[model samples]
Target: MASWSRLGRVGNLAATIIAVAGCGADDVPLTPEPGVAARKVTVIRGDQTYPMTAEVIDWETRPHPQVPERGMAVHITYRFRSTSSDSSAISEHVELQACAVDGRRVVLLCTSIFNGSSKDCWLGPSADPDLARTADVLILPDQMYAGPHAGDPKDHDGYVPPRNLGPGDQL
Candidate 1:
């Protein structure tokens, strides 16, 4: 089965490529709370290797369009924001360069770019509970670039790595 979402503001640039899914509502929740996997990834823009927070901002689960019998399709949307004062480190076209990993092994990955008119780049991840095991989203630093270079997006890069997003953590 494949995971995908209808295009939004960014047209082909907008990607909803979540891979967290299950055979039924029991295997995976019909709706995982938005922002569950609010995590950080290493973003490299030239000499800079900085932190960028990624969050499952929006998500939905439905029957797989191709093989509904296999299970359901999980569509999750995530965005990237530079954690440092220099926010442009994560910008347009950067989301297109990403890899989904399970441990040290790099699994299949494909994402569409949707910055929604800002540097806070959004990408949708279709889900298959089996694929969700590769829960961690790693950034392709070499491919990522700072933005057209502008003011940062509020402060979405608040979540630090090695620790899960908490109630006290500001998003």
Candidate 2:
């Protein structure tokens, strides 16, 4: 009889634990949906030009589904070139232009993130889709940037920020 009572108490405790866990799950927030699918572009260095794969990394979005309200806007990164000439361009600043899948004009800016470094570019508060134009291919010197997140007020000043490669490597 004593053993039966103990078993009953254990069952009650297990049920209470599961109920608490289920209730806590509801408190968790939802991750912000990714803004758009990754877009590809070509990278140009000096006189050489080639097709390259890149994706935009958004900072406003949450990293994990359990942790919402953390992620941000979508951005781009160097992926294909890493195994090719892209990795060799490390520390060498290059320019990349974004074109619509249909090859239409989008937006252009001096980006140093092409070197496959942690650098990231944050779209400023004034960003407008209508005004967005395809980036002009050009060469420039290496530039040092601040943090990779959009929380920085300076990120809106037309400068691309840098972030750890691992954290922002994926779409």
Candidate 3:
């Protein structure tokens, strides 16, 4: 019998597919979420600041459900709204894959899945990776590279080539 965990993976895959279509981050620059006021920051990545509410900063090691040998790395999850809003989890999500930080400037190399199956990447001064957590923006980049997760030995492959940002990858 398939474990509940297995069923969960199948479910999350469908949800992730739908979420990917939205493309949370972009090169055009993400404005602070409308009415939400900017958080206080003594440090700034540039002149820009993105409005992102960090829902979960997971430090736990999560591996690929299919290939447990893959993606044994930590990641952070950001949500546009409360988790309760998710139905099929058809809820919206933007999972940052890797991130590069140049001082206060951060360029998150993001993805939608833990499996090496996704071909998408989103980057910008996303939520702090906590390694060097001092970002001032979430939609612009000075540079992009391996954030903490991509820095992991087992998870590095997913953050390269087609899965990562291009000349100027994701937002």
Candidate topping lDDT: 1
Evaluated with TM-score, which candidate comes out highest? 1
**Cα TM-score of candidate 1:** 0.34
TM-score leaderboard ranking: 1, 2, 3
Candidate 2, residues 1-171: lDDT per residue as tens digits?
A: 999999999999999999988986854443332222234334432234434434443232112344324432223333334435555544444433222111232232223444445545433222223113323222222123322542455454334422222111222
* Winner on TM-score (1 vs 3): 1
Model 3: colliding residue pairs:
97-110, 99-147, 123-171
Q: Single out the weakest 10-residue window by summed lDDT for candidate 2.
A: 161-170
lDDT for each of the candidates?
0.40, 0.36, 0.34
Q: In model 1, which runs have C-alpha deviations exceeding 4 angstroms? A: 1-39, 49-74, 84-93, 102-104, 112-114, 117-137, 144-171
| Model 2 alpha-carbon drift over 4 Å, by segment | 1-38, 50-53, 57-80, 85-87, 97-112, 116-119, 127-171
lDDT for each residue of candidate 3 in 1-171, tens digit (9 for 90 to 100)? 679989999999989998887675542233231121122111112342223222223223344345544333333433332333434322323333233333434333333332122332223322333323423223222112334575466665432312343223323
lDDT of 1 by residue, 87-170 (tens): 564443453233344554444343433334333332223444344444444333332323443234464332212222221222
Backbone Cα, N, C clashes tallied per candidate: 20, 23, 3
Order of the predicted models by lDDT, top scorer first: 1, 2, 3
